[model samples]
Target: MLDTDAWWRDAVIYQVYPRSFADSDGDGMGDLPGITGRLQHLQELGIDAVWLSPFYPSPQHDAGYDVADYRGVDPRFGELGDADKLIAEAHGRGIKVIVDLVPNHTSSEHAWFQAALAAGPGSPERERYIFRSSGEEPPNSWKSVFGGSAWERLPDGDWYLHLFDVSQPDLNWDNPEVRAEFLDVLRFWLDRGVDGFRVDVAHGLVKEANLTDWTTTSTILGGLDPAGPPPPMWDQEGVHEIYRSWRRVLDEYPGGRILVAEAWVAPASRLARYVRPDEMHQAFNFPYLDAPWRPAELRAVIDETLEANDAVGATTTWVLSNHDVVRHASRLGFPVGTPRMPGIGAEDPQPDAALGLRRARAATLLMLGLPGSAYLYQGEELGLPEHTTMPDEFREDPAWERSGHAERGRDGCRVPLPWEADAPSYGFGPTDASWLPQPATWAEYALDRQQGVPGSTWELYRTALSLRREHGLGHGSVVWQEDAFAFRNGDVLVLTNFGSEAVKLPPGARLLVSSEPLDGDGRVPTDVTVWATL
Candidate 1:
């Protein structure tokens, strides 16, 4: 097994969505220089690394996931030289750099796709992708994650499969050439001194050879369709083989590079396989993120995740929010109105603000104190709440178009960072207009406003991360204190009370961190609390 004590184990990784992180050129979109300028901010937050969302050359159909080139940086983000600078600068600050590697599919405009299309059926290049006979229809009744049929009829009358958007055609992992080409892409970045990669949709690399029809056994999100009936190709058996091959390639690198997979599945037991020593170093655990804010549900998810992953010798990771979903602050019913609740309460509720802050702190402590790596989405440390005001005209997410108005897509959470409140674009850029407007509420939530404020969301994150590093919290065996509803890391114990009442700790326990500080003895009876051995 690869060493579980690598730098990334239990490390806090801050994600940067390039298009909205910072804009250095006043072009209204964030770029590499903007990111380079903010390295100190990350360092101050105690993050060990930064996982930049894809900045590769792409048609932007799916906002850069549909990569057209693996080696080149998108001009909007920066040039190849800028990427090298980012790596060097980040390394100098003791912060590892992990770039997004979208290997599951490539943009239809990718050179390989173009070549395959030009070569016609039966050509060697055609095998690099899933191409079927022109006369036949789609092999199965599978739907894309975005919507509609997963199969698209190409101009040549053949069907090309895409699990996501049509612009992103899934690569045929059955083809050795496809495997070799992607491995080369991995090497290309490693050669450039990248610390590691967050493999996008890593589990979807391989699909079942049979391409059988999905079995509608249960209902999916929105109640529109039933799930459980295996989609034509999700969680295919062949995926493990591909992961093993990728692991071999990663092992060859000298840095002992890390690979974190984005795998979300049920039976919890099956999820652990992605992080087996032979596969990835870590895979995201979405159980807590997806579960309702209830004590029993939360407890069960934690218990099941630990139990399921017991045999895997790799670190576990947790995230509450990312670019693709609604912010946790909103999901937990923190005064944020959804379609279900409109104009539902008093204009200003102190309890709402306090609850939101407490929950945010509790979630951070819970994630950081877990026995694995933790991921922090951009702006999450600042406790930036979601803003879903983007008009249809301004929306760039493909999910927006695909889901009609049923879903807001991810544009709200992906909006520009609020760096400076007074700046025209919240310090994202000096431009009068950004690709997406910064939320007006940024005046209060901007980074500058909360940098050192005690009890502030950002400060809580800084404190939690620093404490984890100082006490070596995530490196030891995790013993869950069932009665206290906490996870113990060595002598340090993280206690969380999802309920509103103050949870009484054992008399001898010392307060290490609390979302709400008690007036005396440095203890607060808040939603969440952490205690360490005195």
Candidate 2:
């Protein structure tokens, strides 16, 4: 068993989108019992912790993010007792549980929001959430993440702020009552034996007090042909105050709980602030994930993130894919030159299949060898490729409607896990039909298929995680290489050949793990390689 004290610092956290992970009942949805049943599979993959997305009681408008209650488990996922069993079972297997904390907003149907609406401006509950007068417009013209005005008109003709879906109303972090309520929520889970949290939309806790329109003329979301004014409240400076308070609350726990922030922004320096000791344990560094599949670009992002964040004395975290994004294989030139596979296209063809596996293993090594914690989306360890053809009718993500179908949406990556290759429903459910169809080609990529294969991506993940546990790879300070993509500390050098062709390692460097096989002395004569330790 890995040590629980610093488990998260170097840990490989497997993200389980609870609704899609596994379903015990024939409900065509995943639940706690299903996850509890699958604990041994997670143990086999060597993941130190499991980061379950929000399973709190919600109306299901924003999938569990629109939390109606913070302390209770969603009946759809399971009862409160089921959650306790899952926690205990996970801990029994030496796996820590870090649940997603959506403290930034709550469902519109939540009792707090309902009370605020009923009481209007005069009630003390009015301070629990952001509510503006009918005469006053939203503080600014900030756009909601789901594509409409960030402010919603209430029944009383006033406006309430919602940064994402209209169903998700933003809480008033500046209000002491709001902060105390969330602290109580934190203690609720901590008392239940949850190990830590991956704070959702962490930077949105506080907005600009001036309520001024955005003025920064930068274009990072899309093109900047005629750069538009920046949204007034994307990354306001005041959010840190609340974060420091939350950090203190976490410290009050016995185990010194972990806190990871979902801070997605350009310019690594700006993202680094969230990771300072007083704020968060680490913030997601998405620059590398957003970069093109080019050696120089990847190298530059790695160097800049490490260097800039080093100033703040906090580690960086990396993720390639999650529920919100497309799968990595398709994103990074896999099955090159093909428009995404049709929903009914042939399964990863033979030779191409092996190539895809190799590339995934290489990328996994890159993430693991990086400076901080690494996040693995649910099926990534099995090298699961994206489901290219999610029909419109079956699409559950709000991104589909919000993006006007311009983007394919995140349903591809959020497909249910393929637990049993020959099972009627690929083991996602007892019935053959699931909420989302299991990819027809999942047989070859199922966990059952790859578990014991010596060079499978599954084995590679096991090896990488084991190396991290045995060596202090995630704990050490990173020393960047001048020209290449390498980080070293003392005698240990972790190098990656992001190129397609082979590259020679610095003299005396030994290959600990390589995308391809190495010679007897542990060297990769050709490209797309990584070397660790000595």
Candidate 3:
């Protein structure tokens, strides 16, 4: 079913947002043992691997993206021993593990950053970061990806650049020290038996050599902008060199270690470069994630993604939701053109819950049927919706402070998950403590309610994932038709009717799975996807 050279070609990778997955102790935080304990859910869900987001020591400014240390686990999550056990436990269940690697920047509290701060301007320590002298002003007119100036002035009157938050100082890739350090970081994890890494800000490790001023007017930025050329700080040519060196580290390890890029590049064609034979193994299909739910938009992205990856002999990866943005379920409910803020609040218009659930289920079937690897964000299989009503006082995302409360930030989507319908903390722990509050409404979607119920959301995931492997759907070849899409891998034929009305099935096609029951007339309804054998 999978490509022989690459184990990830058609694998299903589940993402675990550590802080929200499950809490082990009563301290109200998710930890490594909590994840290890919950391995049964993933094993039952039928994913081939699990991608754990960063659990490294941090100020939590960017939710562990700014790593204070690369070699050890943060005490809040657990010690290094807990992580080693988690990896082994997952492996025992036949699931590979991929950890997040943030190479673009490090937490300001990192020893190197502290040294840079204490050493002041023109010191070799400052050379480890991006320090420039433009006389009290920032080096350039560029903006931070979060908000405000990309540069922060130091006590010495010199400025240092941070493309992300001020607490995250960008590393100097031009410096040999930075490059060697990250290579060792990769080895450190690989030696720990991790299968690979999900490289954060993969395209941002290297900036343009000149550090020129930004020429664009669009302040709103995110993964792979739809309307603009590559920004000055992203998708630079020098990045490929860094990846090439890192790729060597992965190759050194056995068991097919890989590097999955979180690179947000455009045109699909440019993204293909990251997956060339010697670079990273795969890049997130952000273009598809950003696409509207319209049939045309979705179709174009699939075609471009497949074509580009085919050119490089690499696999394409698809994802529906993650920790950083609005959940796909809620996003699909809003009017097609509504602005998608990171977090939702009382001021925002409510989305249609019923419509959102239907579309989200349909989207899942569609994504799983596609040819190549897929990623499932934690809680999507349980049909979780974004917690749009998180109170202002509890908000902790940097975007909240950065946006001056005008934007709600991403706390809603990061809410702790519900596992038991009636238990305190919804069975996220033995007690009712969680880093982020679980909504009262989450009981309706708890895993306890969904488990073992035929035609339930949990069963749907188990069935689809099982069928995907049984029928080799992940490595299929897709064929598009009017108002519908179909694909074949081995004996499976997955078809979807994106049109507004029901449609008759192809002759002799026996149904294997459907997102919703068929109508009395046996027509495939709009916003439904089905698997069949012809």
- Index of the highest-lDDT prediction: 3
Candidate 1 structure lDDT = 0.77
Please provide, for model 2 over 1-534, each residue's C-alpha lDDT reduced to its tens digit, 9 standing for 90 to 100: 223246566677899999888989979889999999999988977888899998989998778889999899888899999999999999999999999999889998899988888888757887887777756466556667666677887667678888788888888878988888888888889999998889887766787676676533321122112134434455667878878887888888876587888865556777788877677887877776676555677778878988977788766687887887667755554544443321222233322445555556677776777756888899888788777655667776665566565444567777888877888678888887677777678887777787787877777878878876667667766677776767774445766665554556777666676766765665453335575555
RMSD of 1: 3.7
lDDT of 3 at 283: 94
**Model 1: residues >4 Å from true position, as ranges?**
134-136, 215-229, 334-354, 519-526
Write the candidate numbers in order of decreasing lDDT: 3, 1, 2
TM-score of 2: 0.88
Better candidate by lDDT, 2 or 3: 3
In order of appearance, the predictions have TM-scores of 0.92, 0.88, 0.97
TM-score for candidate 1, please give it: 0.92
Q: What is the TM-score ranking, best to worst?
A: 3, 1, 2
Model 3, residue 110: distance off in Å is 0.4
Weakest 10 consecutive residues of candidate 3 by summed lDDT: 215-224
Clashes in predicted model 3: 0
What is the lDDT of every predicted structure here?
0.77, 0.74, 0.86
lDDT of 1 by residue, 1-534 (tens): 457668877788899999989899998888999899989999899999999999999989988999999999999999999999999999999999999999889999999999989998788888998888746678677777776778888777788888888999999999999988988988899899998889887657778787777744311122111245545455677888887887898888887787888765666778788888788787788766776666677779877877777777667677888887767665555533332211111222222444655677677777788777788999988887666455557777776566554445677778888888788887888775588766667778889889878988888888888888888877866787766677678888777775555666767887777666764644446566665664
Candidate 3 lDDT tens digits, 318-388: 98898887898899888775666667886788788777888888899989988899999999999898887
